[model samples]
Target: MRVVIAGGHGQIALRLERLLAARGDQAVGIIRKVEQAADLRDSSAEPVVLDLETAEPAAVAEVLEGADAAVFAAGAGPGSGSARKDTVDRGAAALFAEAAQRAGVRRHVQVSGMGLDRADDPGMDEVFSAYLKAKAAAEDDLRARDLDWTILRPGRLTDEPGTGQVHLADSVDYGTISRDDVAAVLVALLDEPRTVHHTLELVEGHTPIDEALKRI
Candidate 1:
């Protein structure tokens, strides 16, 4: 399969690229910086320099042309202000989904966060609240699209090595999950057409990745 990923340089995206490449699949990573090209190449993924925040849908569609699937894994980083949360998380995500439609790529996987259910809580930190709202908006947009889309909302992410085990379901309690485990689950989701249109929650658990997916 050929997959184009937004935020190609992100921790999860890089890991996913390596997994895809290792399996002899084509992985295309869309990044804004030319400097990140080498990193993608090291993972055996083709790098395309394109800023989703500024690129028109048609231009992004061009890059996604002939791709088998698209993954939206972009985010504004912890240091970025709330404005960027809207631009990158909400705006960019919407743009990528539209581009996928234009390019005729039916399968899409989105990296979302858990606890979006409380995004509007009044006591939440301003920036964190905005981030949650942005993610919620992005999810809403994808859910309304006609494409075969699966949204994965993982809990707090960690850099610890993946255990290849997880809890996957329509709704899972809030918890922590390793980035490595998240990437592994994404690969399984890509190959599971039965998961289309499902919004799954993920966190560390005893069930193996493949088995967890099967239960879904």
Candidate 2:
């Protein structure tokens, strides 16, 4: 199977690419900078240089042609202002969804924030609030589409090694989860079509990745 990933340079996205390549599946990463292509190549993933921030849906669809699935993992860093949150988080996610439809790709997986409910706090930081709103908007957009979409909302991400265990549910604790484990879950979700149309939250737990997805 072939999967197209947005934000191919991100830590979690790169991990996912390596996993797919290791499994003998093709991985295509969409990056804004041409230089990141080398890094993706090193990880055994093909790279497509497309700036999601400015690209048209038709252009994105062209790259997604013949792909089995698409993953939206792009983000504007914490240091970035709220406007960028709207552009990358909200705007780019929507762009990918539209492109997925145009490309006739029926399956999509969204990597989103855990406990975004807290983002609704009126006193929250403006940037964080904007991110949550963007995430919420992305979720709404995907849920409304005709695609077989699954949203995985993960807790505070860490670089620690994966335990291959996690808690996947509609709501979860605020514990941290490793980027490796998150990638494992993404791959598992892609391998399991039964997980379609479900929105699950993830964090560290004792259940194995496959088992957790199976239970879902």
Candidate 3:
């Protein structure tokens, strides 16, 4: 399968690229900086420079052409403010989905957060809350699209070695999943169309990642 990932330079995105490449699948990384192409090359994935914040839907669709699937994995990052969170996490993600619709790509996946449920509480003015809200909006946009979509909402991400074990639930459940394991789950979902039109909450668990994915 050919996969295109937005915010290709992100850690989890890179890990996903490597996994796809190792499996002899085509992985395309959509980056903002042309210079970052070198970073993606080392992972054996083609890199297409694209600034989601500025790129029009047609321009984004051009990069998505001929791709089998697209993953919305971009974020404004820690140094960014609430406005950027909305712009990149929410607006950019919506733009990507629109572009995918225009390009006729039917399969899409979005990486979201776990705490977006109560993100709008008056007392929850924290940056993390804002981030969750942005993710929630992104998920909503993807869900509204006329395409097969899956939203993976993982809890606190850790850099720890992947255990290849995860808890996959149809509803919000767990609160911690490794980036590597998340990548593994995404790849598994790509192989199973049954997982389409589903939203899953993931966290590191005792079950094998592949086995847990089967339960979904």
Which candidate has the top score in TM-score? 1
Give per-model CA RMSD: 0.7, 0.9, 1.3
- Of candidate 2, the 10-residue stretch with the lowest lDDT total is 114-123
TM-score-wise, the better of 2 and 3 is 2
For residues 145-172, write the lDDT of model 2, one tens digit per residue.
Answer: 9999999999999999999999998777
Per-candidate clash tally: 0, 0, 0
TM-score of each: 0.99, 0.98, 0.96
Better of 2 and 3 by lDDT: 2
- Model 1, CA-based lDDT: 0.96
TM-score for candidate 2: 0.98
Off by over 4 Å in 1: none
Supply candidate 2's per-residue lDDT for 31.
Answer: 95
Ranking by TM-score: 1, 2, 3
lDDT for residue 34 in candidate 3, whole number 0-100:
93
Alpha carbon lDDT at 71, candidate 3:
91
> lDDT (0-100) at residue 54 of candidate 2?
96
Give the candidate number with the greatest lDDT: 1
